[model samples]
Target chain A: MAKKKTSLYREFVKGLWDDNPVLRMLLGLCPALAVTNSAINGLAMGMATTFVLLSSSIIISLLRKVIPHQVRIAGYIVIIATFVTVADKFLAAFLPEISKSLGPYVPLIVVNCLILGRQEAFSSKNNVGRSILDALGMGTGFIFVLVVLGGIREILGSATLFNLQILGDWFNPWMIMILPPGAFLTLGILIGLGNWLNERKVKV
Target chain B: MSLLLLFLSAAIVNNFVLTYFLGICPFVGVSKRVSSAVSMGMAVMFVMTITAAVTWLIYHLLLVPFKIEILEYVSFILVIASLVQLVEMFIKKMSKPLYDTLGIYLPLITTNCAILGLALFSVLREYSFIESLVFGIGAGAGFTLALVLMAGIREELELSNVPKPFKGAGITMIVAGSLALAFMGFAGLI
Candidate 1:
């Protein structure tokens, strides 16, 4: 029982940092860079992704034995796509504004490597309980990064955070920070900082 | 003239990699060498064109007619996966040299969002079948253009002194940011 608990803890903990789907693993860069122009958009995209990841992991884990080895990738994708569809429809139905802002990206979650990667790597091997923990951890990590990226861009680019003015009038917004270049530049620097911080901690 | 604009817009003004952020996995992974980048880009272009055609047909003929459009994601993804497998086999048998160049990247193309994005974007734009085909070719051309350019720059970057933390994907991302900025110049051209 002790060993099982520890393993579960490890599975969850690893995704939070050591194997973060974005900052480290770089599994889902498309969405990480695409939808993070503002804090709310980032949060919405992250939550939607989390919903898909969480549910899909559970389903795939439960069906691991039943899915044939040769077609497991296809099986996992269909499962992920179903949850993505549900998330997409839910967002469109309830959160039309954010849904419109997110655009095709909501449906594009069907292709996000992060969800499929988890099913193929973790969920297929682990039990439902452990897989749930793993998905939540990874989803949280993705959310943290997206929010940070969005916050930084929104603040500098538009002088707002979560739609509230955060900077003074004297501080002119950096228009480039909210554009495509900004997404690439912010993620690039964040990743570098992550590596630098990791190295410093390791040296200690 | 409209077709020309569509092709140009898809190829440059709105590059898939730079503007939409699709296919970033291979963008970062396979861009270390120009030769490999060219091969990967070609493989992607080939698959993307075919996917654009197939997904359009499926969406219109089966999904739209039956009013089961919600199945778009599921069917599109499955189609891409199986198509990649079939392409891999066909190429391996047809031409040894071509397969050797693109063989490794074929499987990876299955997960490339650019493929799926191409399909989705074509549908979203409500492009006619022929227009979708043109958009596919144009987007593929744009992707290849960007990949080759980045690969060339990276090959040169090998000699440059990048900061310790920013040596790999970090530096690549910064370069891509600059590239995106440059590509923005093409805006309003078409």
Candidate 2:
């Protein structure tokens, strides 16, 4: 019983860092790259994604047995698309500004490999409790990375963090930092830094 | 002339992979070698073209007429999935060698956001049927261009002494970043 409990805990913890959906696993790169132009957008995108991920995980865990093997992928996608629609409508209705900024990206989340990958790999096999934990862990990890990435870009590009002026008036903002290339460059270096840290820990 | 502008803009000025970040999965996953990258790019282009035509028809003919645009995501995805399966089967039956070359990536196209993004963008822009077809070809060409460029760089990157941690995805991203910057030159043209 203790061993089983520990393994379940391991599953949740792994996603936090070891198998982080973005930095480590590299799933769902599109949203991670596109929406992180500003800290607020990134944070909103992350939470919305978390909501969809959590809800979908719970539902898929319950329906694991019912969905047959042949059409499982399509089944998972339908479930995901339904949640994505809900998320999209919720954002557009309640948070119009964020919705406008996120634009089609919210709907595009339907194709996010992270959520589908989790369904096929973890949620489909695990019980509801474990699947929820895994989803929360992965979602939180995804949110953390997005917030950090957003902060970096915002601070550099606009001399702000979460819409606050962190940098001094004298600080020259790098316009390119908020541009498309900046997302790729910042994420690349971050991934490299992550790899270096992991290697150091392993070596020690 | 308008179609030419659309083609140029979609293909270079605003690349799907670099500018919009639509197809980063295949961009990163299948971009190791130029040959495979070309094959993958071709496969994606073919699918994107068909997806655009079909989705446009469905959206204009069915969804708009019915007033149930809310079903856009669900219906579009289902259409894309079936289309990919159909394309896969058709290819397998028609040409074994081509099917073998595409391998798993053919099926993976169903999940590639580039195709869906193309569909969504075409709808959002209210593109006419001919314009949507042009847009699809342009987007696919852009995706292929980016992928092939990245693959070529990566092929040469094999010899260089990259830092240990930045060996794989990390370095590829930086290369892509620079390529994006270069591609930005086209932004002025359009």
Candidate 3:
């Protein structure tokens, strides 16, 4: 029982760092680059994705036994699409501003390999409890990367954080930081930093 | 004239992979070699064009008439998945060499956000059927362009490297950043 508890904890903690979806595993790069121009957009996108990931993980974990082997991919996709639709509609109806900003990215969540990957690799094999923990951990990790990435871009590009004026008037905004090239450059550097940190950890 | 502009816009002015950030998975995953990148690009262009046409038909003819627009995501994904399966089987039956080249990438394309992104963007832009088709071709061409360019640069990058940490994906992404900046020059053209 103690061993099982420790394993469960590891499953959750692993996603936070060891197997981060964006940084370490590189599962969901599209949204990690697309909707993260601003910190708020990143936070909103992260929450919506977490909702889909959590819901689908639960459903897939429950249906793991019943869903057949061959058609399981299709089954998992349908489940993910349903949850994505719910998240999309919820955002559209309640948070119109964020929804508008996110645009088709909300629906595009249906195809995010991260959610499907978790279902296939973790949830389909694990129980509901473990799956939920995995989803939460992975979601948190994803959100953390997004917020940091977006925060960096926002601060540099607009001289603000979460839409607040952080830098003084003297600070010149780096216009490139908010553009498409900036997203690629920032993520590349972050990924390099992640690799550097991992190597240091291994050496120590 | 407008259609040509649309094509140019999707292909150059706003590249799907570079600008919109759709389909970064395969862009990074399969772009190690130029030969394979070319094959993957063609395969994606084929499916994307077909998906754009078919999804438009279903959205306009079936979903709109039935007022079942809420089922858009589910239905579109199902269509893309089955379409990829069918295309794979068809290729296997028809052309052996082509199938050998594109076999692995076809299944991967189903989950590629670019296909679905093209579909959704067409819908969002309120493009007509023909416009959507052109948009699809253009987007596919753009994706191919970006992938091939990245692959070329990466191939050269294999010879020279300085940093240990920024070797594979990290260096590739930074190269892509430079490419994106270059592509930005086309923004004024459209």
lDDT of 2 by residue, A1-204 (tens): 999989888878988899999989888899999999999999999999999999999999999999999898899899999999999999999999999999889999999988988998999999999999999999999999999999999999999998889999999999999999999999999999999999999999
TM-score of 2: 0.97
TM-scores for all candidates: the values are: 0.97, 0.97, 0.97
Better of 1 and 2 by DockQ: 1
The digit string of per-residue lDDT tens for model 3 on A1-204 reads 999989989989998999999998888899999988999999999999999999999999999999999888889999999999999999999999999999989999999989988998999999999999999999999999999999999999999999999999999999999999999999999999999999999999
Question: What's the iRMSD of model 2?
Answer: 0.6
TM-score, B chain alone, candidates in order: 0.94, 0.95, 0.94
Model 3 Cα displacement at B29 (Å)?
0.2
CAPRI tier of model 2? high
Counted clashes in each candidate structure: 0, 0, 0
Proportion of native contacts kept per candidate = 0.79, 0.69, 0.78
* lDDT, candidate 1, A28-109, per-residue tens: 9999999999988999999999999999999999999999999998999999889989999998999999999999999888
Badly placed stretches (over 4 Å) of model 1 are: B94-105
The Cα RMSD of model 1 versus the native structure comes to 1.4
lDDT of 2 by residue, B53-95 (tens): 9999999999999998999999999989988898889889997
**Residue A185, model 1, lDDT:** 99
